[model samples]
Target chain A: MQETRLDTARIRAARQVIDPIFLDTPLYRCEALEPVLGCAVSIKLETANPVRSFKARGTELVASLLAGRAAVCASAGNLGQALAWSGRGRGLDVTVVASRFAPAAKLDRIRALDARLELVDGDFDMARERAAAIARSDGIRLVEDSLDIETCEGAATIGLELVDAAPPFDAVLIALGGGALATGVGHVVKTWAPGVEVICVQPLGAPAMTHSWHQRRVVTTDSTDTIADGVAGRRPIPAVLDDLLVVADDAVLVREESIVAGMRMLLDHAGLVVEPSAALGIAAILEDRDRFADRHVATIVCGGNVDMDAYHRWVGARS
Target chain B: MQETRLDTARIRAARQVIDPIFLDTPLYRCEALEPVLGCAVSIKLETANPVRSFKARGTELVASLLAGRAAVCASAGNLGQALAWSGRGRGLDVTVVASRFAPAAKLDRIRALDARLELVDGDFDMARERAAAIARSDGIRLVEDSLDIETCEGAATIGLELVDAAPPFDAVLIALGGGALATGVGHVVKTWAPGVEVICVQPLGAPAMTHSWHQRRVVTTDSTDTIADGVAGRRPIPAVLDDLLVVADDAVLVREESIVAGMRMLLDHAGLVVEPSAALGIAAILEDRDRFADRHVATIVCGGNVDMDAYHRWVGARS
Candidate 1:
């Protein structure tokens, strides 16, 4: 196996630098969910913070390091909001590029956070290209979500906290996006608590990261279609794929129907208004009940920034 | 004012005895809620814990003090779950009495927590009588939710946390139940952060606590009707009423419509699936926006235990 470059020491150091609001989130057994999931389920809730997502942890760390400098990033929603929020009060300047088709709620939030918002005519890929062009032309740094080592290190802090959860989970499930959350968390859990399996979940509509992880190389899809915009990455970052190669034990693609059902399950059982992306972990469990049955399983409810209209359309339909 | 007996020192002391899981809950400003609420709002979330309510703080403290003893209490749902959960590892034996009409979700949760449950044929008052009878006949302790000093003291810990919230709030709002959470939090806030107004909220359908607070005496209503079962007290405890008289600076009663609206607001803007009882504070603000507009205000999102059917009927309807 190739020697892992993701440093446990730096990940540990990132803990102190990450905002306290993102640290020590609720990690407890959801008895209500256990019966439904057919497993002893523990939820690591990352939605209770200001940005309503775990993306802030990495963005905050990355912003802190880039203090007094301007940075640009392309996001469907969450990463942009995190960057704008973390950049505020700090000397750092942030510009977010998003597709015109991005959720209005997310775009409005990004603007409210005082970040520069640039709307592209095309999809997320085009937005990424626009961000890169802006960064080059404006002589500013382009901060890629998972491609940044600091972003991964910041996310690894969650793994540190997860290992300390009582009764100890047999497996940990993470939502796979550009691979920051999954790989970052996977690295720490695999390195420290080797006994616990790190399973990454992706929407079947957008399974580039999962496919790339399995193939042990970079992969791209022609298009993406999913309610879980957070994990709908058509193109997987090669560096993050490398991290997943060593760290992630397995990756699963869940049906779109399962995502909606998972959202309803979380709302009914756990009293959480989670985005579809956050529901992917639960959907993964719902897809393969036998693998997790009777075992203590932990999953990070990673975000809760869903648009109300979409939420009603998706989850309300199930109810 | 009459001499205050809800001890600030005991409330502070109770902090250490309470479960760590119930302490240091998310206390942050929700920006998305600000525009809708017409104010700078900070939500003290008590819903993300094991029991999904602030009830655990008091129950844990009360349970700890009653170590190796048998205790009984009547609850709508949250309190019973708290007691059952808190009394688990301890030598304490817990019994919960409830009206047959109590939400099935709560009943199932209480039963799951290993507490002995007694269902009464009539209302909550009938359940209370049954609990008292059980206590007397079995030689067990009758643990009143707010009447017990430890319960209030445990709840007072939230006030301690609130006073430390950043940018400092102009006023704090709390949902009125048996008066433990409101009076406990009020006593601490009024005593320590006297500049911050302690406002208590009750549903218009069940305004016994509000009426009692305004009238400066105990008051009883023939019936109570509200979706917020946690705060649907028809009769106010005289002792807890006395504490409320001293601690609470103001009390507001909001309509059932407003309570439903508040739940929707929390769900849409704050990304929290709070129950009607927990939404009382938000309802109060919505009813009288002029009183809270532009002011920095704090409200305890005190619980998240709601029947899914009720959630859909109330919040889902608005969407």
Candidate 2:
């Protein structure tokens, strides 16, 4: 297999295809948070997207490529909603195989998009297997986040937008799942702004990417539990792992509680409605503020698809 | 007093001053809602702003003009938080006099901006009286929403941005309170897009603006109460009334339940968090879907500052 790198050329191509559908989300300097962290902390608010997540960029790209074909994917929440929206917009039939663990609000959104919903009995991995089988049988396009080159290319546009919007940031923090966003964004940042650091944040319970980066091999876990359902996947695609190893500067594993706190912080101070997965980068920063001191740091708010019940519970507990 | 119409010249001036401080919120077609509404429905999503409201634009404009002077304002929620944020950013001392009826989350946000908060005993009118008194006694600039031409001009920038972003719209729906946003936006829309109909939506419990429009005078009520606290003021400012008489096409009062449902609709379908005042426009559309059939209409989502407790209750009621 050829190693894929999200270079400037790929980012340019991605922008040409994805710009119409994807929002160039704002990268605003957090004056209040900057003083607390001792750094010029900024937030790349991906939650401002039409689908309320960065997943829309990748899904839009992949959907556009599959112009006339049906699409199939599996997700706990955000990715499925993004695919459904993009697929619907492009006049493609989308079938989302979702785990029972998926948030109800997300399921409602997928249904509202008029996409077929298949509820799997087991975990996200099991749902992924069902989607893969269906896609293979029906000749539907499978838009895998990690393995798909188009997806990586689409995610890389974030880096392009960031560079165009603000000056060279000292560090960029991204939430890690199957490593597509981290690898894609990291590659672009390193290419365009070589001095910048790329830090990946993962849930402690689901640190497959972190472990893979440390061991220099692809890794998978049998089970992982975290509030960041969007980025709780255990397996890493080999292609994404290869790119991440080359470009990522460091990785941080954030606690579930901290992710919740990060969401609260954004809602309180920044007036942003972000899900736990989207808050991972902020959680990592809050965990180790000293690392970002005196630097111009940026963090991606990956998505906002929190379950209302769960959100209420989290808010109540915090109070 | 002279009627303050935000003509093209004033709008251009406002845009020059406000472009740097405020986000030019996207005016995108809502494809999903279009099919349901049988029209080309566009949404001007002000919830995408850094402060999560269009009020930020007006507040930033007013704060910049103040130039480090002490300022005071009264709000049910969104306006106070916006002023506090803009004032803090511009190094101005801000005192927000909020009513007991305001959302706790909004008060929290105002405090987070380092504004001095005075929680008044009564409703918005009482709070405004207190704010006016404080402003007079302390020699602070009073940033009243309606009477301030700068604030109205700042809010008019939304119309300019919308016209620049999309094709001519047939109609626009705005949530009305102190009427700065509705009046300002109406002025520009009527001037630039002459055929466009400007409709103002107010909560039935607090129909001061609607009554004023119908009676052809500024009207005041003994009391006003509604979930849309941001627009629940009793008395209408003379300037706002004059602007409304000249520019507005009609006014509609939405039920409190419908406002809650509209907020939920936005959260579920659009994945955007909007407060009750922001939901009023959507509520109007939902109430009379036939009026917009096959027409190109735009609605302004004015703010996002609901308390978690109140939000939970609304969600609970729906379930």
Per-residue error (Å), model 1, residue B30? 0.7
Q: Per-residue alpha-carbon lDDT of model 2 for A1-319, expressed as tens digits?
A: 1245665676787777774536566677766455556677778877655566788778878888787679898887777888888888788789999988788878877897888999999878888899999999998888777678777777888888776655678999999997778888887877778688899999998988899998999889988889888888877878789898888999889998888888877765565667888888888888998888788888998887777668756645332
Per-residue lDDT for B297 in model 1? 92
Q: Give every prediction's interface RMSD.
A: 2.3, 4.5
Model 2, B1-319: lDDT tens per residue? 1244666686787766664536566566665555555777677878655566788888878888886789999888777888888888788899999997688878877888899999999999899999999999998888888778877877888888766655688889999998888888888877778688999999999998899999998889989878888889898888779888888999999898888877877665565667889888778888888888778888898887777557657745322
Error of 2 at B235 (Å): 2.2
Deviation from native of the Cα of residue B122 in model 1, angstroms: 2.5
Find the 10 residues in a row with the least total lDDT in model 2 chain A. A310-319
Q: Interface RMSD for candidate number 2?
A: 4.5
